[model samples]
Target: MSTLGVNTGWRARAACRDHDPELFFPTAHSGPARAAQAAAAKRVCAGCPVREACLRFALAHLPHGVAGGLDEDERRAVRRRGAVGRPVARPGPRVLARRARAGGCSAAQVAMWLGVSTRTVHRWTAGGAA
Candidate 1:
């Protein structure tokens, strides 16, 4: 059920591709369960040939869950530290809104990550200015 699109090359080589995706979106909010889930996901990234590429992709495209061996918080710290040059602008607001919703996080959360207002995110989602 995989769709073809950008990053297909690196993604094809990703080790996590063989595992359940929910593993990357840890069900637990915090404490032991969350740590275990993140550890499990990171194990997949530990040996991935496309690990760097995946990390770069996550830095730009992912706003929640575990990706490229790091959780969303970790990625946020990385972004703040300016450790990578990933572009966070490839997807327009609408696309990001859909992705945010699909990821079980609010578009407002995504907008916060991107330094925009929640109302602005709502406007983007509705295809209008608020």
Candidate 2:
């Protein structure tokens, strides 16, 4: 019963909780092993009651691995489709600097929050370039 309405206790009922963590995060060079592992993980996710919540969380924060019966690429596709009607504008350097100063966060933290790169945040913070 968090603010997100995701039951924390639901994790105890997850099938993959006791499994190897590596199975969920396959590398690009994994080849067949990746498919096999993703399938296995998806099977586990299929029976989880919090599957939707898991997917939403993955799309927002995890950014990698097989979650809620979908892989990273699948989640990325879902996000793209979800944003089809609404275009997101990138924050300007002044906005980034303001957020960093107000939150007392580092360039890397601000970059991650803005979905940019650490180098980009550095340039913005340093007033070098946009």
Candidate 3:
């Protein structure tokens, strides 16, 4: 038994009516028309009850597809600014080594602490002073 007969209605539509590419894809003008469509998509997402869920599902499953009214750029930005309460990681070894050396830890000692080669430590020291 397929659920294709179910009447999902406009409420379940992912994109806004105004921004629906179905309307614009055929007759859209040049840049201006595309911009208008993007704006419309964002507006629909702004007040959508299922916005987050829609976005999450889109990103998790169809990472290449736009959903919840967001295009690729908007969805990427949303994912980049995620606020799920986890702390951000600091910069990598070169940055850490420079900071440590600046704070007076010798290159070898910093290497020992960080478990990296002394050549790496020297490279960081050289890069930082540049």
TM-scores for all candidates: the values are 0.60, 0.52, 0.36
Residue pairs with backbone overlap in model 3 = none
Residue 52, model 3: Cα distance from true site in angstroms: 1.0
lDDT of 1 by residue, 1-130 (tens): 2323445477877999899998899888875456556656876876899877788878878899888767898899889978786533234446645555455556656565545788776766664321
Over 1-130, each residue of candidate 3 has an lDDT whose tens digit, in order, gives: 2133432344355444445455323234434344344434445566677655555555544454345555655456656888323332334657756766776667777676567899989977894641
Residue-pair clash count for candidate 2: 0
- On lDDT, who's better, 1 or 2? 1
| Local accuracy by lDDT, each model | 0.70, 0.63, 0.54
The top-ranked prediction according to TM-score is: 1
- Residue-level lDDT tens digits of model 2 in 1-130: 4535544565666677888987788764454345455655766776788776666667676678998667887777778878522332334546645555444566655565556788877666664332
* Candidate 3 RMSD to the correct structure: 17.1
Instruction: Rank candidates, lDDT, best first.
Output: 1, 2, 3
TM-score, cand. 2: 0.52
**Cα shift from native, residue 40, model 3 (Å):** 1.5
